[model samples]
Target: MNLKNTMLKITTVVAVVISFIACEDDFATVGSSVIGEPGFNASLYDDAMISAHSYDLPAVQTNNLPLNLLGVYRDEVFGTQEASILSNLLLTSENPSFGTEPVVDSVVLAIPYFSREVLEDDEVVYALDSIYGSSPFKLSVYESNYFLNTFDPETNFEQAQRYYSNLEPQIMSNINPDVLYETESFEPSAEERTEYIVDGSGVTDTVTMAPALRLKLNNNFFQNKILDKAGTASLLNQSNFKNYFRGLYLKADEVSNGGTMMLLNLLHSDAGITIYYKTKVVDATDLDDDDDFEELIEVRRSYTLKFGGVRVNTFEQEVPQFEGENLFLKGGEGSMAVIELFSGPDANNDGISDELEFLRDNDWLINEANLEFFVNRDYTTGTNLNEAERLYLYDLNNNSILADYILENVGQPNSTSSAANRLHLQPLTRDENGNGVKYRIRVTNHIDELLNRDSTNVKLGLVVTQNVNLISTYRVLPSANPEVQRVPGGALLTPEGTVLYGPNAEDEDKRLKLKIYYTEPKN
Candidate 1:
């Protein structure tokens, strides 16, 4: 008889028949898990747990049971899973105070201090919503070149048979003498995969995490922009990927402490290196809109890094690095010199400062020929191209002046293309990652606390005249007792635990979940 999960109601599960030959001495100690049968309090996460069981049905009609038996068995298995799932599941609900008035920038304080709780909810929702699944492409992420390749129909179907053999009666018999089963594996054809590809589910917010990603992005911070992960440094230096910025939808109704992270793509062409900022759409309507879903990129901003050729393109070469704790712009070619931006009140400043200050303050902006006989630091009296008296402008010897690379042409290329693939819950495929990348702004309780402070301030700009090191400096004052926690209805997985899941195929954009609620200007 067919048994639906709803029909099972509160009926206890029937025990399966035994098949294993057992001896009294063979009654191996039934590994006691100390579960359900005892008084121990057990905390089970129904959705996150994976379970599997095997047992023989002593009441089988015959070894050669009718095909219908297979269908019945599958249904029974499904219902059992459903019951277990429903035990701890929470249904979705709307808050009573959800006014269309639009929360905007006006936020409220969260009681009991929790940001991780909020982040957990966001992750759980994302997993349930089908976020971050398998890649559309079958390749690993390519920092340079990457592509997705699947089999042709003939080849795909040819390989599919290998799965069917596992479904045969003989195979099922091996599993259990009374075994009668059905197979449930239907993959899309190549044409179907390419044509009817619907992927890119937004990240869910029904999960919980610990060590709460205080910097994790939220639902509406920076309009869900993804940052370019890497930028090429001039002169063969390994590009720094994580140092860039990433904007995210922040979750913060009330201020506390939390944050988000994002990836970036830094490209290096022979002429120069270009940085692009990218984002994805997470509109509430998109959820209800079940149209041809594809992860699309929303372009943000781009910057070109200006660094002298790796080997001192000019008379002098300077490479930037950190020493004795503080970072300094070192490694110049022709001359060994030091450049300092701020001197008097520059305790927190770097070595390279503004170009304007050198000319006006230190009188070092003149051309090299004029520095009294153009003597190199090596004491080499050289015949400079300038006059016997005039100085060479843009000198590299000044320890206080920073040289600026004036951008002549900032070309905004029209290299637009749609991201066609779904990131379902399988191994994360590399197709979702594109050469084009960006830095998105992300927010959480951390910023709210920042906005609350009187001396709270931050700046976004290049460190020197030359566009290098996109600095996002937050002039933060340390707190003795930092109050950072998860959001309400959210849990901090122990030891930085995560309750995240993705479909074998789902939304391609890997989600960095935010917890605070937000709405667009028009609602």
Candidate 2:
């Protein structure tokens, strides 16, 4: 029998069997009887040689991120991390006019937090999401003279400008001496805010909005910088306006005892600086009675400057030292673990491990391969840190997701549900008490390629991720590994971390390992 044709037929049969089992939601129960062939039998072999090492990540690119983290957080194991934001303001309209005698009433800056509405006692209330810690932190906003460019001049303006998370020091140097807004003890609130409006009939109406980080800015600064520059060359267009008023730097500082961190959606429609002021308008109270009777009256008006154009998130973290016993995975300029499968002595020096060569020589039909990582319960049992709900694995050499990840995520919606891609990248398993147990990740296709298709066995990078569906990679400045120039973008969006037992752990039962189930001819 031709070996190439025989293997092709076997691979096709395995694909059909796997698809059938996946439909039944019993993918892990592949047994010998499933093949339904008397000449073949299925078996399990899990003594694969594996090596894993943890490494600290350098400051990553944080500009133009989908979500921004603000405030401070101190992890018992990873030390303290403070997040801040630097964003350029955009004009609401070109050549905006505030009418006659535009006097500033109040300039308010509002950025909504990630929250969900819940009905309690027949009244609607909100519960915040993605907010870590409960302590207050100092928040300050300053006028920045630094220009955030759209493209990098070093790249001949062809590439988008990249900003690192550790660029806060350089940003601070360009900020104006006078602060725009400051709060010594600022905490995120879940209470709704009521905005009262007075119409022409002198009737007051109230409108309630969702929970947000709302602060009153310095009105005097807006009065001179904005209201006074109406119809001038500075306010002619967005380009001129951005240059005149660079932007604002929102900084977070640690408190005495503890600190809080919140993930904010700064690009929300309602997130911006609203300037409420009294402007001169024609009085229409008696205009109907006499057409010539024109009286200039002060009327309430407001205009907003949106938070847009080259927004960047800055992260300051304390890098944790890695020991070989356990692996640490954190997001946002944190650490990640490198994994090598079938990594043992290669006496032939053919670049292939001896253990992998033996498996290939057996001609065993690969059915399933998985990596199980048990969480280190000792460090996380009673801690306040919010552990990541998911972890992402990718090919470090190619800077892409593994073949198994792509196959499993097919036709699956982008969601945070643990059951979405359960067959491939299983979510963090939690016990009855909400403690993480272990994560079982399927690398069946990846293993098949290495064992049967003569593919290179590349190193895998694992990191805590906010969502598994986000496979886009972001460049990391000063990358620790030359092969690891980028990391998953979802990892940067997460503020959680986890510790897992590595292969070198003293507890052999929970040590990370690769288990492969195969089928072979009954010779």
Candidate 3:
């Protein structure tokens, strides 16, 4: 028989079997004349059939978002990932006031680092979180003469702008015509620095601050761009300033062996450019003295320009293994894994779709459901190759989020208490022997809806947890509180991947699993 006809026949047989079983149970109900009395306590429903399969997800758009760049780096398992950033500089003030006789001291660019702290015993130890392969590559900064057009004149619809992952740098002739600033290979530091804080009584106490990247820019470059035209009309407003000074393009030069990559948070409060100078001031202390009558003294002055405006992170991925197999779960937007639950092949082909249908035919109360993914330890256990700390699971077909993710308030406030966080799965953990490190994603509500409600069963997508909220923002409506705009959002641009065991892998013990815990009614 055809597949549809066979399914109908199996469903008919399941209905008949259920009716017969009900009849038998009804016959056994002898002493239930008094209504509202419980029939029997409960019985365990042990046997539950679960189906799982995985496929290679198509490449997704990885650009025109808030994702920061991960500079040049090459991994043995994940191949190469090189990233660059193009952004506009924002003015700190409308009309910058640099006094006459100002002397340029220095120009500096600062980008903050991302770090986390762990409790060693009683004290907390800080470490870099999203950084990998910390060797170091030559870093360069160039003035980007290529202007990012804010609006498209043709459509005039605010221009739903987007830049792709595979796009190359369209360098302009005004790119300084020379490298503005170049630095030798440098590694990011996790060490802390001491900062002295003075109280109202002038008593000082030292505290540690996080590490950051502060590059000293060329003084001559900024002297001409910023200081020379202090009183000009172009320097009177931010719009005129941006139009005159274009932007910057930060490029990390190529490196042969294992080059390093660092993830920077340009939007951090500490990340920006500062121009230091000294303006002429009269020595008023000795003005009354004939020895120092109105002597010119250098008084320090500084103006800051923050990193903002049309910041776009471009990503390029070269994962050849992704073309040949489906064994790993890559986190970047360019590549990710497709997950299918209850929608794989048939029982004859080693899939569990048919098995799930069989269980659905039988009326069983699903107590809890979970999906666990085991990492391919053979490929992910090197000194440099570490596993991602958190992973996010979402519905792939919807291009939105799973309803359970919202109902459970996965990333919202106060959703992290013991009872509240039950919906959010625990972090990556391993067995006692430390052999199989796995991640478990809770899908009890998803399974319950699939089995009980009229919800659509679509494939799911998995990625690093940070990618979920990378481009998410609140949109205000007429009556409701701000709603989230989630679709077409960006994913992780940082180059990171984890090899997870698929359902069809060779090892049965380490294969992906969909486990369901249930209970059956007793009479």
Candidate 4:
């Protein structure tokens, strides 16, 4: 058989395959117009075959299991987001060392704040990535007097061991003063400490360190809660201690308009509460003096307590756009936006959308399929918080992720032939103005499957890229290994929100579109 004969036979097989793949609908009559007659030039096929449209969908639920506190952030465009944290504290040692005649000196709470980046080169560089705004905001710490049970007593199972973001705080208000400490004139700033390395001769090199929020907590609170429970059963075991003293709730007070929010690293080793106390010890130098064998010395020691058990960060967001024609997209379970792609008027009346119906019958092979999203800079740019750099698009039905995310995770190629096997999400890009402008995602395989294969056209979700997965290596797919899925949600610990041009937008180009570039095979 010659090359032309072989090509003719291949096209015949493909046509038979399409018959088996495409549903029996009115689109069958237009089959010849789909792929065109034999002996077609590939170069003639360009954007002529490509058809694009968009539709606005409802918002979906966000899995807001954050690792750190998001604090209180108020944006003119996105509105207000006030976050509070609830955590169970853990002791450093089994039986803490509070020596003889332990006297409480002072109790301090240290929370390490994180900037987006750290400068390596010298000369006072300000890499203000995290912690937007500098205005003053109040923070209050309270004791969670009530017991936060791990599991339900009725059913002794781990399945019931869960705390939601909406759980009410069981504070110690019954006591005279429930407030542990409250600071109104508090300022959170990065501390640059100069450290010198003294090896053999003298000072060698100097290093600078980031600063933390060091608040002097009420000494009486620790003196009663920790120092008092020295050798008791409460201090001996962690569970007992948690039951005896529930935990702490850090609440952020809202400022009028221009106040800033800090991104706290709660899991950092330096972020914790330290109780300073003095213990009596034997004086070794005074041993020579028979009368002065033991001396009352102000021996300062500290026991650090950190968040070990379940820590839940809650968010209260207000997006005014939801009231109008706009679609609101925010991170954390507080708020999220969904997308219904390739849906609207089925112009061809073939039981499928005009674009899908057109592509269904067309014999052209898709080269590239790009889904572009424009930013709503009209409102978002005016706000203090900038637009989110990246957005994660996933299957709305499963809440697990699209084939694109999975294929990207496994390092597989996404092409028209592999359309049955892969769907690749788009990487984030910035405009020349150094701001997030548009997001162009590639979903060639996804579109190919929808057009030629028997696959469900499930709605897709758009959310902050950070909310998808903290550990980049881990993938949220059942097809993925057990270890990858076990990583769990890292939580949305930052107070950030973004507004995007939805399909319902009045502007045509700004609206989301599924653009395809295709070419007809040589006959």
Q: lDDT of each prediction vs. the true structure?
A: 0.16, 0.82, 0.59, 0.56
lDDT per residue as tens, model 3, 270-300: 7778787767657666534657847876566
- Candidates in order, TM-scores: namely 0.14, 0.89, 0.75, 0.73
RMSD of each: 38.8, 5.1, 9.1, 10.3
Instruction: Summing lDDT over every window of 10 consecutive residues in candidate 1, give the lowest-scoring window.
Output: 80-89
Please write out the lDDT profile of model 4 over residues 162-203, one tens digit for every residue.
454444333324222568788775556665434333232112
Q: For residues 301-385, write the lDDT of model 1, one tens digit per residue.
A: 3223321211100010112221221111111011111111112222235432222122123211110000001111111112111
Higher lDDT: candidate 2 or 3? Answer: 2
lDDT of 2 by residue, 165-265 (tens): 98898999999979989988999999988765546433447789999999999999999999999989999999998999999999999976568988888
Q: How far in Å is the alpha carbon of 236 misplaced in model 4?
A: 1.3
Q: Give the TM-score of candidate 2.
A: 0.89
How would you order the candidates by TM-score, starting with the best? 2, 3, 4, 1
Using lDDT, rank the candidates from best to worst: 2, 3, 4, 1
TM-score, candidate number 4: 0.73
List candidate 2 segments past 4 Å from native: 1-36, 196-205, 283-293, 409-419, 479-483
How many pairs collide in each candidate, listed in order?
A: 90, 0, 0, 8
TM-score winner: 2
Q: Between 3 and 4, whose lDDT is larger?
A: 3
